[model samples]
Target: MSSDQVKNEIRRFLKSDDKLALCLRGKWGVGKTYTWDALLAEAFGNDTVSPQKYAYVSLFGLETLSDVRKSVFEHTVGAASFRETKDLEATFSSISERVAQLASKWRAGIGIIRGVPVVADYGGLVEAGFLDVRDQIVCFDDLERMSDGLDLKDVLGLISFLKEKKRCKVVLLLNSDALKEQDADDFRVQLEKVIDINLEYDPTSAEAIEIAIPNRSTLRSRLVAEYATTLGITNLRTVFKSLRICERLEEVLKGYDERVISQAFHSACLFAFALYQPNDAPPLETILKNRPYSDLFGNKEEKTPEQIQHAELLRRYRFLKVDGLDLVVFNSIRTGVYADELIKREADLIAAQLDLNDKDAAFTKAWDIYHDSFDDNGEEFAQALKQSIAENAVAISPSNLSASIATLKQLGHGEGTNDIIAAYIGSRGEGKEFWVGDPILPRFNVEDPDVKAAFASKAAEFADNRTLEEVATSIVRQSGWDNSDLDYLDQKTAEDFYKAIKEAKGEQLRLLVYGLTYFRNVGNPDPRMSSITTKAIEALQRLGRESEINRLRVSKFGVEVPAA
Candidate 1:
């Protein structure tokens, strides 16, 4: 039922003198209890509802009927008093008055000592207090989570007793889907005897968002609701969690532009759902990969149901990829701890880039030629793209620059692809190392061979500039080396290797020799390994033969120091 329909049903139940029990059932975390409580608060404020006393007890860990009965007595309260002060003090006073009244009625069961009644058992008094719990609206929640020791049949019997015997209005809230098979069967058998009305509390995405984020006037809440609706997230708990994350983002990004806030909010909504509702949303790893549209073409593999759903969700949200700011939002959601300074740092960078993009409206429009229309503006867009690349190529990220290059090449603008690559490379000074750890080209999907060759040339140039000391330090720092690092080492001659070892002393010399010996000990896995290890072994032998102290130091390593 819709939330409004459920509310009306509940209002009718409260207004009518129907002592029958109402069962509000739905999936877990769908706000069954939240909706019930909201309706109760409204009912408490209104004078049309008949019941003035209320009790809400969770059967989550209650193991027996007696435990449930004690809980009901403990939680009972007057609606008028609770609405006014929102405290249970009045309930305690009322319970005390009832207990005194019942104690007089049961005085004969107690033995009198020194003219005072001596009550040996308090269970009877508790039962008496519970017996006074009639004519009130009582809600039992989490019936599915009741302990195994508690029988479903017994709980249902108690609900029947509340409705038929005590003359109280009873409401049972549970996730029927969460019941075990046997329990479900048992509940079905017993539900007919106790429950007079059953309402399925499934709210739509908009209804749930209304229940979760009541004040949707704010931009943050509106964005959260928009993305949540797009993602079809109807779980109010997940919506509330997403809203909390957005609130944190808003607090950290208080003075930022709306566009910046909008980006963060959208990312926060997606990542929050991924974090809290993994079954309904994509996994965190998938989100972190930031490749929503990857592998769309050039592949013939069948997509799984989950993949198809995720693709649709990503398409609807227009979530092409995650950027630096999204990573910050993701970390905040995953860790549940916000680094205010880190968030602000990322937000500030995004704000600056947004401002830059705004100033370069032509650059933005150039991309819109591909995304915003199917018109024959190909020539106009191509010219604009090249112009933008010439002007703002330095500001664009490598991946985005490569995408633009690919787009240009697709439009028969292949002649200018090399110039764009050169401009981008020139903007990044030679001092900056384009290649680190590996020589593999970035998977930017740039199809032009010249662009790839340019990148390879840049990587090789960076590798060639590495001094032996820098290379050895890098090897030791990483504890190993890849083929590229070995390839760099392979370029050196035996005499050059000897010079590198000769320049080091003490621990540095030992560590450098040890790092090189790793390749030698590994049986030369790479073809360059043979030359590099042979040259390193020759260099170590040369160092050992130079002096008696060097011979002792090199011998301590247990490496074979061949004679010169």
Candidate 2:
């Protein structure tokens, strides 16, 4: 049974005033030790059980045999001399003398002891008369680790003896992985036949706490957005081996559980996307644990600098929405952020802080709030961003640079100047300030993204439920051009693409037609493709023009983990 069920069985058996024994078996790293530690703590604190009456032990490491005998003698007699610890007394005369001494103790014990020796610490406790024989609980751990391998006869004797006790509970705990699969089966079979109750580990609650739940509903989305943003700059791509990276991060940042550990593993895969972001990359030298906080307006709690940066990235991306407020990100490469909503929210906050008039007062104080100590190297780090904008891109919005930068850094992916600028700007959005320079970037001949959109729509249709030929035929029909002028498109390739569009029949032919159409609608997508050529017609034939290329490159090398 599962851990919870085992705990339940233990609870039920306890009501009978029986000595309870529970066996917990599982692989070592699967959380056996961790679960038991938690269960023991919770069990003893339960109102129904008296803590002093129960104890736990590992059979393999109890103590010297000599110490065991001494303890047994003391407990049984209420007090026993060190000299009387063993009937053998180091130098026994013979077996006859030992038997006689043992009989003498039974006689002396009969009058002094009120109850039979039914309860014991271990199997050896039977000889010491410590077994209460009626009501008690004994938990044994690591019994498999005992020096002398346990024999079948000995196990049978122990089970039969416990059954005879009738009112005792026996608990056994094992790390399943430590044993061979063969021996494990036999042990489990034996345990299941005798155990009255069983339990398994419950780490979900603990794992939840480690990730800081309850507060998560408010912050998890924002956190994920920021994480995703970082992945962009770092060029995170979908790859299988990334599992280990994420797993370790989760263990370091949160805690471990089967579910949480699994997520940590996947997170590493997901972060590959963030790792390859084109702009605002994570600090190259420092670990995420040491990264600085980027959020100027955030909780001043004991959070790492990276966390603050994460929060700021969320705000810039609009991944986080302020309740009861309309937010907008405006750019001004010269000045800084401009938020219509924040201006209103903070306008009042500033007026209230300064105790200004209610009329034009809010705006009057808002101006001071906007420019308040806005300098380089301040806690907000406002000046650093402002400087970058002043030097390169414009700070188009006073709203939330963090969110804008985050979005641009994630989406504005390219190579060289155009790519760096695109990634930087795309983090914010495809807004007007982010227009491509004519020389470095070419404009799509088609005003509408319809050509590319049509390809995706049909591709989805085919993927869901359609034959390849049907999809090919459908695409060919849609991609056929009705006009001949072709406008400013690359002359030679455009004519040939139009000719190919006329002759195509199957999937490959359809793909070429689609590629040409997409080029007509969207600029060259692959950064690597630029080195190949920019000819509108011929670029369609370029290899590896997939939009996923930028992300894949970034992921492989993590040059960009967007921080904005």
Candidate 3:
């Protein structure tokens, strides 16, 4: 039945003093309880209205008849009259007074013993407080979750007692799909013997979302609600949770642009839906590919019965497709690409505001001058040369002058670099900055072949003292090259290493290959070595030393050697 028709049936059932029981069955989270409460709210004018007292007791943890009675007593309000009153506390207080009067009257004729009443009726008064269900509406929810010790027959017997004996109107709310197969089979006979009416609740997707998410004024909320309805999300609980996540995203992304916020909304809703419907959730990669939920069923053969059922459920909910949301856009939002760009742009704006007060910006401005100068602009070249001198004018040792000059020479700006260095040294004449034996002197004098040869000799000498492992580690650290950082390496060094190992025979070669193993563990390289370490393997390949590479691949790196 539609939710409205069910509500109308309930209203009719309630308006008449019928001593019959109604069973409302649906899938979990379709808002059976909410619909019933809405009717109650309408009839009573307020949530706290005690008009025609009612008891709402969930059978979830109740294990016995006593537990059921206790729940009813705890939840029941006012008298059987179900009178119109908005004050729940006052109504309950009046019930307590009435029960106390009943207890006093029962004890009036009893004799006293040692100043104590002959009859103590505290439990009786508490029982008389609300145990009589006649003329009141009593609801039992979560019937499927009732403790196993409480048999269905016993529950039905209690329902019969309330209807036939007490003449109370009873409602039983349950998700029939959630019941175990054997229990469901058993319920066929027992439920029929008790309930006077069975109302099947299958709320439409739109009704579900509307009831689930009441705050639909915001654009994000409405978008999520509409998307949920389109996706065939009929579970009101899931819809409520998804809308809440969207609302939180709206607050978190308040200042973000619309595109970014919309992206966030889709991602957040999908994540929430995944949590709520884990079994039906599509694989993340499939979702990212924008494939329909129906695609989740394997095409290796014909669809299985379970797959067909899931497909039908998806069809019913309208969630079978990518509908109204693109996976690529959702992925961008999920991965924060737009947010990263916005952060970078914000950083640039802040740097502009800080101007020269930002040290990082000042250094960047210095590079801008060098960049323009290296591009063949005479005026920029002169300006860069002038700035280089002033930047190193304080007679500072290891100044920025040598680094900028080296960079300029690396860019093929030999004359410009020489001019900048000359002006910097002239400004620091006869000072420590112009030390004749300074380490920075050779690095800056790139135009001199002697200086270059001398530096190369020193580098070769350094490499000779350092083992291949140490060299590999130094290169890895300096270049920040991981195992995955492929396609880049020093060809000359790799070639030299290959030649060195080739000349070494027996144990010497084995020890030489041993150093490459150290790179296998540098900052988490799993089975493969780092890029600098892989350079060693490449060297072996260059010299056709497949045997050695194969041995090292398995013994040290835990990887199989690739086919030559």
Candidate No. with top TM-score: 1
For candidate 2, lDDT tens digit of each residue in 91-186?
A: 323323433444456557774432444232223333443433234444556656654445533543454455556444556676655666656677
Off by over 4 Å in 3: 46-51, 79-95, 109-124, 128-131, 279-564
TM-score of structure candidate 2: 0.32
TM-score of 3: 0.51
lDDT of 1 at 290: 55
User: Positional deviation of 420 in candidate 3, in angstroms?
Assistant: 35
Model-by-model lDDT, in order? 0.77, 0.38, 0.60
Model 1, 210-284: lDDT tens digits are 777788788978889888988888888888888888888899889889998899989888887887788778777
Residue 457, candidate 1: how far off, in angstroms? 25
What is the alpha-carbon lDDT for the whole of candidate 1? 0.77
- The predicted structure with the larger lDDT, 2 or 3, is 3
Note each model's CA RMSD in angstroms: 11.5, 23.0, 15.5
Identify the superior model by TM-score, candidate 2 or candidate 3.
Answer: 3
Rank ordering of all candidates by TM-score, starting from the highest:
1, 3, 2
lDDT winner: 1
For candidate 2, the lDDT comes to 0.38
